[model samples]
Target: MQKPALDIHEIPSPGKWFLLSIQHLFAMFGSTVLVPFLTGLDPAIALITSGIGTLTFILITKGQMPSYLGSSFAFIAPIIAAKASGGPGAAMMGAFLAGLVYSIVAIIIKRLGSGWIMKLLPSVVVGPVIMVIGLGLAATAVNMAMNDADGKYSLTNFSVALVTLAITITFSIFGRGFFSIIPVLLGIIGGYAFAYTQGLVDFQKVIDAKWFAVPDFTIPFLTYTPGISWTIILLMVPVAVVTISEHIGHQIVLGNVINRDLFQKPGLHRSLLGDGVATMLASLLGGPPSVTYGENIGVLAITRAYSVYLFVGSAVMAIVFGFVGKISALISTIPTPVMGGVSILLFGIIASSGLRTMIDDKIDFGEKRNLVIASVILVLGIGGAVIHIGQSFQVEGMALSAIIGVLLNLVLPEAKKGE
Candidate 1:
């Protein structure tokens, strides 16, 4: 489905472009930085790498797909697991392999066309996969909000988180026009102010930071202690399969918003390849993997500005900020509970989007097949079911749930509407 074409000129004025680009930057900043904060990677590196990745994506996709690439939440579990056993090097290896999987899939799509993706992961499968991505993180969000970083419950932090969350929701529901698209930023500010008032914020880091400094870059493969582990790589590679569904969904939504068939234009293979290569590059630099940012999509949906230049400008801005250590330090001072507050809302929106996908597609829950697929997926994903395979391998959470949903959808026969 497509809407009417945008008519505010192919390029906005320089001033407008800068303002819009800043909006895009803010839209993506929260999730991008959060990935590193959660995974213990350098937030500075993540920002720079994501900026570079977004630019690479644009160049490879021929500036056709107007999306920003930012840190992915999908790799949080896998990266954390790898870090536990083999540290950040192992996590980088895992993320690197995941990027390779995306590239491989892109190659396959280039040869085979995109129809098979639909047959394999229909709405019945994708809807639950998305839901799992959101629900699976619910506990983490709650924990961060209610408990201190050391796992001790803190009433102070919880109260701060509540304030942030309430303000975010209020803005999302009642704010109009462009402001409506920035609930995350508003929430963070509102929460930050409250935390600062309570003396939770430490401004020394920000004060000590230089206005401009080089990002601390690391090459994971070169610095790995015990070398790369094939097991870790293989374990993380399958994550791309889940993210591919999200990639497709994002393109569909963006296409709908801008009234353009982006998938048909640049083609999903190009988009996949671009994102894959971007993620690969980012991982090699010890930064979190990148994905199409939903926040930026919200910006696009409201502004109705699909110009590729806007994203380019935003990427450049992000890269500039990445070099400014002061900015990173300031963002870091946002406090855990404040982030937790925003995350609860952000994560819930992710789950709701999945529901919206199913609803918009008119997926019939009356069918036993649909019911079973969704039910099993929800339980396995949200209930924390893990499947062990052999002595050295296991699958659980979103990845496990996604694979199971796809298989079930493929095996089950579609019921006739009247039958």
Candidate 2:
């Protein structure tokens, strides 16, 4: 018997729908704004990119499943590394290429099935790599919260920072209902309120800022000075491989939650294309590359309102806020300690995701070969290992770690039978 046709428009009451949309918005709020804040991109543009990306995802997925696409945290380290080595524009170029990488992988998945892609990125390799990605940036997030971009200690009130961090941690660990999902937002609010009491906030920026303004979109321009570092490009490309796996995993989770095979229906190809296009769009507009947000999955589990229209409402709200310069200023003004406090949990969650990936796959951890591969990748990646073969030729850090992992897997002999 054919399953009853699911109703895409069967939304709950109008009031409930709006409330649920707000829940999703809050779930995605902290990380979305935090991306541009860290990368030195216009926060308004990040908002626009996220809004546009989410909308594109919905349309491409044919409204079959509900999810939100937002600014990716994985790109933060890469962007910073690129800016230090090249410039901000170079980082954008690398990110743009990364989007293209996603497209190519998507096409490959379409042709060969996702199993082939999974073989290249098994749980052991991906798990440690992702954990390293988070732990690698742990110090940076803490440092930023206490100091300004200039490295000066603007946060004279260390107590406030501590309080902010405490609030975020407390709420994240023990808070109930929607509050738990929004610990970062609450922490920000708590920190900002404390800052206001202490006269730390500069209201002039908020007052002087225009109520409505266009997003400050910038185009990527090629430069010969840095001369297109192949090392940087190659380093960033494989990161996309991990993100693509995340995309597929998210799709599967959402499919089960909503009781629809989104991968086969709207087709995984189209969803991948949509994500690629959105990331390219974000990169062109001077924002970090975009990715499907997993936090929205938490929202889905909580609300149990699997309607796509709620996501549509979120997209509309985010776009409307994107045009508001004052709102961007307010978000930009969030105190660092609060962000630091929040990052304590957020970054940990990122690392935990890697662990979950490994656990979910039921990786054969006892296998000597698998154990060796995972250990080497984790240590090399997190230890800041570098390889230099003369002046102009070198590979280092996560790039080197990823390449070494892949080579080790291919070259190493397979596990013996009945070992």
Candidate 3:
């Protein structure tokens, strides 16, 4: 029972188009901005870079794909480590190297028809990895949801998060049209208004801020710091394994939503190239690394709006907002609990999508090899086991788990078709 999809070429009226574009932007905002908020990067720069990255993706894919590039949660820990060890320069360099890894993969995929990708990382591996990603971030979401004014855990913040979560769930399940599609935005508004009644919001910054101010952009290698080495690149590039798996999973989900084989047209190679180039550009500008946003996919599932034109509009709007400091500052003032509430739903959907992938493909969970691969990947990923090499090199969490899963899948022989 698939709903009819809006064609890629179909254009709604100007008013409707503007609203839909903003809805897409709203869909991506919580996740996109959170990367910068968590990693101490400039939110304005992140937005601009994401906007550019997304446009680059569309161009490279020949406007066939409808996706928005946002700052990747996968790189949060690595970036933090890189910053502490060397500097922002080291961190950006690491991300740039990760992009190079994507480029190399794209080259391989272009030549080798992507069949090996499925053989190496099937549903048994990817599904558990996706589950681990959501579970791994559970603590962060809870902490933020309970953070008080003094930055300590408090029941007041928890209450607000609960209210936000409730509203979001209600709207997503029952609300009609735009309300249903943009539940996260409505949830934030509802929670923010409630907080305002309690005098939690500070309006001083908004009042003091100018109407328009140029964005403070930083060039990573030139302005942020100076230095790049093979060690930094090696430590970071391999982490692309997790993001790549996530990318493939998302493409599969998007194909289901739109009822089209995106994997065929434009194909994985083009998408990977687009993602790699965009990520590299973002890193060069000291912005957090970008990835295709799963949040937007959730929006499409809810709204059934599959027009690529809306994505272009969203990209243009993000670029416009990036040039305005006051707007970015205003968005930054959203309460932590509000975002925490959204994250709970958002991350859950991502995990569920992975499950959907497994079920749709009818992966044989009864098979001993499949069961073992899934089991090991989930435990290692969620348990936070780190493999340290000397002082400067390490791989752990989802990245390490994904690598292990791939290797195991390679070594294990699959059962004969009818066995």
lDDT of each: 0.84, 0.77, 0.80
lDDT of 1 by residue, 1-419 (tens): 44423332367789878988898998888788888887788898998999999999999998878899999887876788778877887787788778888888889889999998878878878887788778888888899899987899999999999999999999889988877877888888999999999889999999999999886666853565535655575457767877888898888888777776877788899999999999989988889998998889888877777778888899998889888989988987889999899889878887887888799889999899999999999998888777777856767676778778888988899997589
Candidate 2 residue spans exceeding 4 A from truth: 1-14, 146-158, 221-228, 389-394
Between prediction 2 and prediction 3, which has the larger TM-score? 2
Candidate 2: TM-score? 0.91
Candidate 3 Cα misplacement greater than 4 A, ranges? 1-6, 10-13, 149-151, 226-235, 256-260, 295-307, 416-419
Q: Write the per-residue lDDT of candidate 2 for residues 1-419, one digit (tens) a residue.
A: 23322235567678877888888888888889887777777878888888888898788767766888998887777888777777777787788888888888778878887777667877777787778778877887677667764677765545567777788888888999989888877887897898778766777778888999886676755322323577668656767866776788888887776667887888788788778878888877777888888788777766667788888888888888889989987887776666666676677788888888889889787888888888898889788888876655556666677777877877888788887
Better of 1 and 3 by lDDT: 1
Clashing pairs in 3: none
TM-score of each: 0.93, 0.91, 0.89
lDDT per residue (tens digit) for residues 1-419 in model 3: 56545666677779878988898898887678878876778888888898899999999999888899999877876787678778778888889889988899999999998998777667787777777767777777787788875779888778888888889899889988667766777888898787677666777776777767766556754577657765565446756876887788778888888887988998999998899999999988888988998779877787787888888889899888887767777777777787787777766775676677678779788999988988898889789987887875667677778789889988999899888
Which residue pairs overlap in candidate 2's backbone?
none
